[model samples]
Target: MPLRVSRTPTIRHYVMTAPTFFSVEYAINPWMDPTTPVDTHRALDQWDALRRTYKELGHTVELVEPVAGLPDMVYAANGGVLVNGKAVVARFAHPQRAAESDAYAEWMSRHGYPPVRTEHVNEGQGDFLAAGRILLGGHGFRTDIRAHREIARAVGMPVVSLRLVDPRFYHLDTALTVLDDSTVAYYPPAFDAPSCHRLREVFPDALEVADADAHVLGLNAVSDGYHVVLPAAATGFAAQLRAAGFRPVGVDLSELLKGGGSVKCCTLEVHS
Candidate 1:
């Protein structure tokens, strides 16, 4: 039987990790201070805690094999997007992170997710935002212009390509998040004129997350109706979400952040 996702409904999320959770390239630069045993232990503890939290929260999780030697696989959000009840395998352009998608594809297959297709079109899942319509960002990441159309074709929804500028942010989700059908939290500077126009075309009343809060990837919030989960570090951001009429729940991502991921990266959601 084919498991289907309503165009809008509950999303079952999965978290994957290899043995690399304890041994990852937490820092982008090798020259940075190396990972300490304390950091590793902290990361491992947090990861295990995250798994339990998700299962407790009603989402499914699977810890898969680590990609051969890649240190970043632990922050698996970059691999793909589980949408329309299908696993759309992402083609990441980052030289170091491109291999992560392979594992995502394999896992989706093993789990009976929809067929995996390549979108050499984009590189970062940060750029892929699921909303009333799916929006993909490029100009900053490897999300090719054509990938937007491909995404539309794959899901039978409009995949709008939001313009981006380089060296600003790695993914759109890093700087922005769609809190609901209309509200958004983000760093305003991240969007170019055309991008903002595109957004205004639909959601004219989005909430703006502060730069200080968004800096910690706070804008990358995950929600299911009234419930939301974020990094403990983003307490203020969480409060802001509450102030904006949301029910906020949070968790610690100290270890996950150290590995370049946050709450959103840890879970793949099916928005209701």
Candidate 2:
């Protein structure tokens, strides 16, 4: 099926109380440090600032109530991938996050997004990233490679499977950020040889982020064609975005970084 293209402005939806229960309850990825103490208040402040930044950019914002005991719930992008107002609910791999699927379904149903439930293990936007009409899917951690087929069936778009070699860049969003309909910025070393070659072939002119910037979760960013929202710490990546003709808006979410998520992790793009 041809991808849905509309003239309406893109809306960046987010969960308001994401950090209300945010903390490192378990060690899932390399970014997760159980020993690092989390400050709930700091997390809340940072998240709020990110929301405001989105609004300031003239994008509509939506919220899902944070459910208690679901600390990872704050990483809202993992809930599902929204396409043309329909949602493909994610099936989390960890038992600790299994309950999140239902919460996301309820939110989608309540907000007029019909949900497509899939049994294949996936982590929503964490592994599923859309670039124009193509869906780039990640495997080797968090999500199962078979889930790409289910997502392709659900969204009716070609899903490209990319194997992540490094655990630090476990999710596709961590390794790449879709800057625009035809452009992307990625960390080449994060993917396996075949996957890296595939990405280079697909996006031949794609920007390559430096290792220092990737280490700070720079590629885990949100872009709305013209404006790219990212972590303030990623100075090098920010410069690259500007050079690519995008306005880079940086916000500090170091508190949520404790849970191995960044700006894109806290935001979800809802298509109309």
Candidate 3:
């Protein structure tokens, strides 16, 4: 039998692109060790596997054209977060990825999505995730705290700010994943004391992932309420998801992990 996503009342759409120009040429996060070389060929193969996984589970997948010299462009989630047919483009903190803003903007414009250029620096869904009525955002690294307010105003949702403590968990999507409208999974160590407390207050029953899984970018996974797409190496977390009654489909994205990205990093939800 083919694995299927347990559909919610509303459908969700995601955008991703093949890793045609992925490489770890610069160091942005702790996960990126420039000394370690990345195999672009293997990265593409893994990315294709993930894309196929999404399609197999019954989800619409859109692609953003890959351009030369933009290695990080393959991490589509950083482009921007889409909500209500509007996209708030990311003003990247690093010069290396600054060019990606326009590339994502062109795609949105062509697709009838009006782009709202954010004033503060934010890395799209990489730092922002929409869960039900609220938006969860992260800062203390690539994204500025001020960007959270900008995102809230642009998207017209109440935004909750979670401060990331660990450099390896620089992005919110890296340390935390929204499993459903009410449930979430997170690596507690990635957040500070207060942020952890806040997460507990908001999601008291949030699933906690072990460090063994977190280290492999397991928390940086994608979920459509029922089906979860994550790194194949995160066996512990995969078993946990299955136990929670959600279908966990593992995809090997080890090559992209050289650049500090996994499944969620390459996926961007396009809300209608």
Candidate 4:
């Protein structure tokens, strides 16, 4: 099936909330926490600022009620993938996150998004992306191999499964964002040879960022095919992207690091 992606207006509207509104164990696990008073302030500011940035760019903004106990819940976009105006609630691999898929489905319906069923067997939105083709990732997170295949069957688009090598960069978007189907920007070490081969076989000239850049999830990037988003601190990566033809829009997400999230993690891109 042809995946129709509407260019959601430069004024795309996204739903968001702050870490202060919900709690994640952001203190101990270096893999996921950025907990400190400084961290909290930064995270809250980033969340609100990101929403404002989207609005400034012409997208609509809706703030959802923060899920009471889960900090991961604040990174709402992972619970689902919005495709062709429909929302498919992701089946989280982590049992702790299973409840979120249903939550997203209900929220999407209330907001009038085209209804798409929820699945608990798939891991999370970290595994899915849609452009000319459907690309999904299988990382240490909640997304599974079965979920990848199911997404293809459900969405009627070809799916590419990225088996992950690092748990830190748990989502496909953390390292790969399609640049018009003909190009992509990603860090290589997080992926095995077969995975990189599949991507390169299709887009031989795809821009590749070094793994050193991927460590801080530096490769975690977002773009509307017009403006690309990454860490404001990652000036070098931003320069690389800018040089490659995408207008760069950097945001300070150092606060999200405490909760193991970032710009791409904070919002789900509901394509036009």
lDDT by residue (tens digit), candidate 1, 60-91: 77776776667667766666766666567778
lDDT of 2 by residue, 1-272 (tens): 53433212355554433678898988888888878899999999999999999889888887888889999998888999887556898899889888988988888898888789887898998998888888899999989988889889988889989999999998899989988767789999999899889888999879999999999999989988877889999999999877766788999999999899999898877755
Top candidate on lDDT is 3
Q: Which stretches of candidate 4 lie over 4 Å from their true place?
A: 1-13, 26-30, 33-39, 114-120, 139-141
Q: Work out the TM-score per prediction.
A: 0.82, 0.94, 0.95, 0.85
Candidate 1 weakest lDDT stretch, 10 residues? 2-11
lDDT of 3 by residue, 1-272 (tens): 54643545334688886778887889988888878988999999999998888888788899999988899998999999898666888899999999999999988899988789888899999999888788899998989999889889887888999999899899999999999988899999999999999999999768999999999999999998888899999999999888777888889999998899999999988976
Q: Distance (Å) between predicted and true CA of 50, model 1? A: 2.6
lDDT of 1 at 138: 48
Worst 10 residues of 4 by lDDT: 2-11
Worst 10 residues of 3 by lDDT: 2-11
Which regions of candidate 1 fall more than 4 Å away from where they truly are?
1-11, 18-38, 119-121, 136-139, 166-168, 270-272
Count steric clashes of candidate 2: 0
**Per-residue lDDT for 1-272 in model 4, tens only?**
53433333244556665566545544423455443444556677777877777777766767666665666777776867766555677766566666766667777789787445534456445667665555555554456676666666665666777777766666777777665545678777768889889878877867888756666666666666767767777677777776776777888787676666677777766754
Candidates 3 and 4 compared by lDDT, better number: 3
C-alpha lDDT of candidate 2 relative to the true structure: 0.86
